[model samples]
Target: MNSPDVSALEITSSQACRVALRGPELIIEAANKAFVRSAGRDGFLGLPGWEAFPELRGQGYLELLDQVYRTKKPFVGLKMPILFQPSKGAPMEEHVTDFIYRPIEDGSGHVTGVFIESYDRTEWARA
Candidate 1:
């Protein structure tokens, strides 16, 4: 049997609204164009989610990430409030979104990471 190339498994999905968090530390892996717009930051990769958005630590997002990482279960959050800084040393602005945290498994079925898909719902939430 011929082994497939690992790069072939990579997701270059055109979902338009996607973010990838990997490892037990929940490090940011990739933030797509839509995700960058929603997150307000283009450079989150190599930083842990908590480090990127410390404000979310005690806001239940960290715990939720932990749950998904440990339990390997998917989580869906609706109209969740998030504070994002557009740039370093900038003020944090609140945004609302509906998101899903899904587990990514290797070919052997071992959970390896979490994939985040979210839709901005701030305008509707403000109404």
Candidate 2:
């Protein structure tokens, strides 16, 4: 059987708001345009997840990421409420979203990173 094309997967992921984080610190490794816009900050690329969104520090997201990294498990969240700033110095806005945090493993079967994908559903939720 022929293997599926990896590029196709990359292409599909690129269309969504997605980010890849590496190491236990969850340093930002890569992100798509949508993810960058969603973050609403500059200079987040290379920063730890906590540093990237300081406002999210107490929101349990870091703990969730830690659990996923430790257990090599994936987390799926549906219609979750999130508050974030649209830009620096902007007031926080509430958004409902669906998201996934998938563990990334190396050939040795050790978890190495996390792949996060999110879909905004605020309008749908408000309608």
Candidate 3:
């Protein structure tokens, strides 16, 4: 599926939004560096399916995506809990500082992909 180029986005999206684009099948089309770091994935580009994000699975993220795609509307989520896999032990959960899911629009005004924004809620890595 054809999607917008990452380079087409403004510099603000790169710095502030932690934006990324997913294709028709939710394949990661492109991701800014912030997104890579936040997800703790090094090579995030080209990953397929929404399932690629373990924290997002069955956690209302998919449902949110579906709602955005169907309505072609932008959504913002604040202080939501984002479950993360810990390095030393079992999975850990933290409140997401903030996030946004915006539907990408095609020339025909149809939803083609989505733009993501995420913020890590941990403080100073004290854990």
Candidate 4:
């Protein structure tokens, strides 16, 4: 496996609160610091989204992502509920977030991947 570019990850980390890139086959190609903070672990690069976060499978997110990928359309979720283990070997916690899954296209306009940009809204939802 190739190493993730530290400088690129650092740049992405600085640009967004939660950012990730999912390449073909839904493998996670990149993730930012905030994403790691939310996931409670790192090393997700090259894993399928569902495999990386098994808790999301039955929660409709997997299907949603598949739909977005197959249709090559963007999806926006407001206050989407996600369950994630804060730490490896820790209990899972539910978080509310606003997210967008935008289709990334290549030069020929074919969708090559999905770019995820998100903001945690758990606190706001509890208010």
User: Top model by TM-score, which number?
Assistant: 2
* Full-model lDDT, candidate 1: 0.73
Clashing pairs in 2: none
Please give the TM-score that candidate 1 achieves against the real structure.
Answer: 0.79
Candidate order (TM-score):
2, 4, 1, 3
Query: Candidate 1: where are CA atoms >4 Å away?
Result: 1-16
**lDDT score for residue 28 of model 1:** 83
Task: Kindly list the per-residue Cα lDDT of model 4 for residues 86-118, writing each as its tens digit.
Answer: 887898899898988777666566666677778
lDDT of 2 at 18: 81
TM-score of each: 0.79, 0.88, 0.73, 0.84
For model 3, the superposed segments whose C-alpha errors exceed 4 Å read 1-13, 86-90, 124-127
Kindly give the number of clashing pairs for every candidate. Answer: 0, 0, 0, 0
Ranking by lDDT: 2, 4, 1, 3
Evaluate residue 56 in candidate 4 and report its C-alpha lDDT on the 0 to 100 scale: 79
Candidate 3 residue pairs in clash (backbone atoms < 3 Å): none
Q: How far does residue 64 in candidate 1 sit from its true spot (Å)? A: 0.8
lDDT of 3 at 109: 69
